[model samples]
Target chain A: MTKPADTGMTEASAPVILGQNSGPLSRAISRLRGHSFAVANLLMAPTMLWLLLFLALPLGVILVYSFGSRGTYGDVIYGFAFDNYLRAFSPIWLPVILRSFLFAGIATALTLAMGYPLAYFIAIYGGRRKSIYLILVMVPFWTSYLIRTYSWIVILRSQGVVNTILQWANIIDNPLDLLNTPFSVILGLTYGFLPFMTLPLYASLEKLDKSLIEAAWDLGASRIWALLTVTIPLSIPGIIAGTLLVFIPAVGDFVTPDLLGGPDTLMIGNVIQQQFLSARDWAYGSALSFSLMAILLIGIFLYVRKVGTENLA
Target chain B: MNDGTPSTIEQCEDCAIRLEGVTKRFGDFTAVEKMDLGIRRGEFFSLLGPSGCGKTTTLRMIAGFEEPSEGAILLDGVDVARLPPYRRNVNTVFQNYALFPHLNVEKNVAFGLKRKKLPKDEIATRVADALRMVELGDRATYKPDQLSGGMQQRVALARALVNLPSVLLLDEPLGALDLKLRRQMQLELKHIHKNVGITFIYVTHDQEEALTMSDRIAVMNMGTVEQVGSPEELYESPGSRFVASFIGTSNFIDGVVQWTATEGSIVLGDGERVIIELPEDGSRPVTVELSVRPEKIRLRESGEEVQPGQCMLRGTVRDVVYLGMTTQYSLHIPSLDRVFSVLEQNVEIASDQTLWVSGEEAILTWHPSHNRMLPSSGA
Candidate 1:
C-alpha cells in the first residue's frame, strides 16, 4: 500500500519521448498533430485526382458542349445557345427518351423479381454452402460482357437453342420470331444486371436478425404478412442501393440495344450514339446526355424523399 | 394422495400449459425428451438450465415456433401440437428483443392489434397504454435502433403483452442487460406479471434470477427435467445430486449408511463416522449420497464444543473470499480427502478478525436436518 503511491507518482511524471523536439522535422510533426484531417486528406489525394481527371473533366467538357451548335462542316461552332437543349426536348426525341426510361424500369423490376428469391434462399437457407452460392452469382462477371450478350443471342434466336427445342417439342409449328425484339433487349439487360441487384440484397438480408421474423410470427402474423412488413422493410437499404446501381446504368446501356433491338426498339442511348458516331453532332449528344443526368437526378431525389435515405448505406 | 402434484398423464384443466410426453429431436440429437410438466394459471414459472440443456427448445415448442417431434402440448386443455405460431393464442419475447427496427414504438406495439383488425382509435389507446406500462410513453415515435437496450426490451414486452395472450413465453428476455438493469427489470417484470395476471413461462440460465422471480422452477439438465418445485422447496429439498449442485453450490459426501428407524450414521470413505437424520419416509438404505449447502455449514474455531445431534467435521481453512454480506471459506477436510465450503453470514465482524483467516483450523457443523440424502442413482 505504501509503494503504490510512489509508483503512481513515477508514472504520472513520466517524460515525453518526442525524440529531441528541437529539430525542424520534429517541429513539422508537431504542427501536423494540430490538424488531424490533413493526414486523411493526404491519403485521399490520389483517388481525388483520378476522379477529377476521368469523371469531372469529361462532365465539364460535356456541360460546355451542351451550349454549342453544329457547324456546316460537322464541326462544333462553340457558340453559346440553347438550340440543342430545345431540340433535345422536342417531340421528335421524346419517344426515344421515354422508351429508354421504360426499358430500364422494366429490366430493374424483372431483375428484382428474379434476384430477391435467390438472395433470400442463399441468405436464409444456404447453410454451410452460402459462400459457394454467392460465388455462383458472380461467375458471369468472369466472361467478357460481349461474349455473354452474344450467348443470349444463341439462346433466343429463331433457329437457336430455344427455337429448336420448341419446334422439336411441337410447341410451335414454325420457328418463332424470338430475336431482334424489345423483349430480347430487356431480357439481355436483366440477365447482365442480375448480380448487381442480388449481391446488395444478399448483404442486407444476411445481416437481418432472423429472430425478428420469429417475433412477428409470435405476435400473430402470417408468413406472407411478416415478409411484407418485417423482412422487406428491413431490407430497404439494400433495395435502394441495388435499384440505383442497376437502373442508373441500364438507362445508359447501348450494347444490349445495339446487338438485340429491332429498328422499332430505338432508345435514347441509340440516338445519342448515332449523333456522336454517325451523325457527327457532338453538341446535340452532349445536350441529350446532360438532360438525361438532370432527369435521373430529379428522379432519384424524389425517390429518396419518398423512401427515406436514413437507412441507406 | 396427500401431495397436490398431479400424477403423470393426469389431465388438469386448471393448468395453463401442459406438456405430455413431449420429445423433440433434430436428426439424432434429442433436444427435449419425454417431458411432462404443468404450469398453473397466472403463475410465474421458469425453466432454468444451461445453454444446451433444452430450456429454449421447450419455450419454442410452447410458442408454436417448433412442433415437437412427438407427443402433445396442451394450452388451456387444448392440444396445439400441429398449429403454427400465428394461429396460437400465445406470444414470445425474444432474448435479442427482436423489435422491428423500421417501426416506431407505438406502431410496433400496435402491430398485433392491427392484425386483429381493431379500430384505429382503439389501437392508438391500447398502444399508448402498453407504452406507458413499460414507461416508454414519450418514446412512442422513436425507432428501436434509437432506444437503449433496456428500452428496446420494454418495447418488445409491450408488443407481446398488448395482445393479452393467455400465455406469455419469454426466452431469456433480460439476458443482454447489465446486472443492475437486469435486477431492476426483474422486479418490474414481477410487478407486471402480478398486474396482468397472465401465465408467464420464462426461460433463463441464471439461478438467482429464477429464485427471485419464479413461483415454481423446472430445473432442466441435458434435455430432461431434473426437478420441478417452488424455489424454496427446490433449494431446501433437492431430489437429486444434479439439482443440489446445479441450482447452487453443494458439498457431496458419500458413505455406507448405518441407521436405526429415527436417525442414521455414515461411515465415510475413510471410516470416519458422522451422524445424520433419517428421511421421514423411513425406508432405510445401504448407502447414501448426502448434499449439504455451503451456508448450512457453520465454521467455528478449532476445539469448540458442537451441540449434540449436530453433524460436525474437523477441517482447516484453505481459502477465504469476502463478499459484502457473507464470507466464503474453503475448508480442507483431511479424513474425507475433500475440500468443503462454508458460507458464514457477516452480520458483524469481530473486532479482532474478519471472519476466518486462511490457514486457520476450524470445525464445520450443521443440524442433521440439513443433510439432504440424494436419491439412489438410477432410481
Candidate 2:
C-alpha cells in the first residue's frame, strides 16, 4: 500500500522542486512528505482494528458488566454495584478458587517435571534425530486437545483400558478409582499443556551453550552437579516461560475439569461457567474472570520483576 | 601448594601427562591415531596442526572428555583412562572461554575450589589471587557477558587456574581473540605457566601461536604426529615433509639424488645441481626433496662472489613483496618453471629501494647446511 505513495512522493517532489512551483498541488506534496505519522497509522490500521473489535471492546464490555447487577428472569440490568466481586470473596466461593489454584499449580509442576527431561533429551542427546523428537513432542497436537483429554478418560476410567489391564494381569482384585477426581483433573491439565511447557524449555535449552556444561564438568563438577549449577541456571528463562504457558491457561481451564472432575472437585472455571450460562449471571461471571486476570497479572508481574525482564525467553 | 615457586631440577624431570599410544575414533573415522606423547612438569607443550588434525582430540583425551578407543592416558604416572573429567587431575581452558553466564567472575573462578569443599577463607583468598593473576580483580562481581571478550577469556583462565591442577589443558584458549589481544594473552598465559609451574598442554591450529608460546611442539597431520621438537628444532630440522610445510613457509626443491659425498648434491628436473649436506649414515634415497626457508636464501646480483660451500641458483625476479621488516623476492627460474621465494631483511635498505623490479636477473644462494632434506613420502 505504501509503495505507490513512496514512488509518487519521489516522482512528484522532483518535478515540484525542479519547476519551483508553490501551488496547492506542491503544498500538498510537501505536506504529504511530512505526514509519515499518517502513513504509519495507515500501516497499523488492520492490527488496531482487530484489537479494538475483538480484544479491547470485549474487555471493556466485561469490565462494565462486572460492575452491573443481575436482573430477575436471567437478564443483565445496567446498574453500578460491587456485589458480584464481593460475593466472589465470600466463603461459599473461596473453596472453588482455592481448588482451581491447587489443580493449576499441581498441573504446572507435573508438566515442568516431565517436560524438562524431555526437552533436555531432545536438546542435548537427540543428535541428528532432534527434529524427529520435536515432531514427536508435537504429534499430540495433531489431534484435538479435547479428544486427547477424552482419551485419558478412556484410559483412567473404572473398567477402562488401565483397570481392565490391571485386572487381567491379576495385580488388583478390584479396579482402583482413577477417574472423576482431582487427580484426573490435574492429569488432564498436565497432558493438555505438556507441549506448551516443552517447547519453550526446548528453545531455551537449545540456545544454552554446550561448552558451559563441559566447562563446569572440567572444573570438577559431577554430571548432576553440572546439570544443577550450569544447565538449570542457564535454562531459567525457559522454566519461567514454560510455567507461565502452562499455569495461566491451566488456571482458567474449564473443559478439562468439567469433563474429568467429580462433584467434590469443583474449580473457579466451573463456577464462572455456571454463572454465565446456567445461572445466567453474566456480571458475576465477568467479576470472577476479572479477578482471575488480576491475580494472574499480579503474580506474573512479581515473577518477571524478580527474574528480570531481560531474562524472559 | 608450592607457593608459585619454580620446581627444582629433580621435580622437572617428572612427566606430568603421558599419552601411551592413545587413539580416538569416531565410528569409522579416526580423530587421533596411536599418539604417544609426554608433557614434562613445568613445561608448556603445544599440539599444533591444521583443523581436523586431531590436536583437539588429543587434548580432550588427556582431559578425560574423550576416552581413547585404543590404549590409555596417564596423568602424573597414574592411568586415568577410566576416570571422568571431574576425577582427572586436570582442567581445560576452552577456546570460547566458556564462562558461566549466570555466575559472576568471583564465583566463576571459585567454582572448582568450591567443588573441592574448601574452607570459605581459603576459597576467597585463592579466588582473589587468581583474579589478581589475570589482572581482573576489580571485575569480580561482573558476569561473563558483562565483560569484554579478552576479559572473559581471562576469567576463564583464572577459573581453571584456581584449581591448581597437576596439568592445565588449553584448547586454543586465545583462538577467539583479535590478533593484538591474542598476542597479549599468549604472553600472559606463558607467564602464568611459569609462575604456577604446572604442566600445560595447549592445542592450537595456528602455527605461529604454537611457535611463540610453546617450549616444545608436536606437529600433527592426518591423525598422526609428524614431528615433535622444540620451536627451533621444528623450524630448523623438521623430520617430515608435512612438518616442514606446516610449521613455516619453505621452498621445496624436488629432485633426485645424483651422488653422495661430503658435499652432496641433487640433480633437478632441468639437470641443474644444488648442493646439500646429506645425513651422516650416507644412505641417500633415489629421490629426495629439500626445504629451504625463504629467510635463509640471499638475493645477490649476478657474478657476485659466492662463498665456498654455498649453493646458488640464477633466476629472474618475478615479483617483490615489500613487507615491513623484510622484502620477499619471488624468483622465477626458466629451467625449473617455478618461483623460489627469497626473503631478504631490509636492514639498511630504505623502503623506496626495497622494491626489486620484476624481470631483473637475481642469484639466490644459501649455505649448504641450510638445505634440510625432507622424508621421501611427500605431503
**TM-score for chain B of each model, two decimals:** 0.95, 0.93
Candidate 2, lDDT over the whole model: 0.86
Per-residue lDDT of model 2, residues B166-241, tens digit only: 9999999888887667777888999998999888989999999899899999888989877777899999988777
Tell me the TM-score of model 1.
Answer: 0.91
Residue pairs with backbone atoms closer than 3 Å in model 2 (clashes): none
> By DockQ, who's the top model here?
1
Give the per-residue lDDT of model 1 (tens digit) for A227-285: 99999989888888888889999898898998888897888888888988898899999
Q: Once superposed on the true structure, which residue ranges of model 1 sit more than 4 Å away at CA?
A: A1-43, A71-77, A309-313, B1-13, B268-272
Runs with alpha carbons beyond 4 Å of true place in candidate 2: A1-49, A307-313, B1-13, B267-272, B350-355
Give model 2's TM-score versus the native structure: 0.90
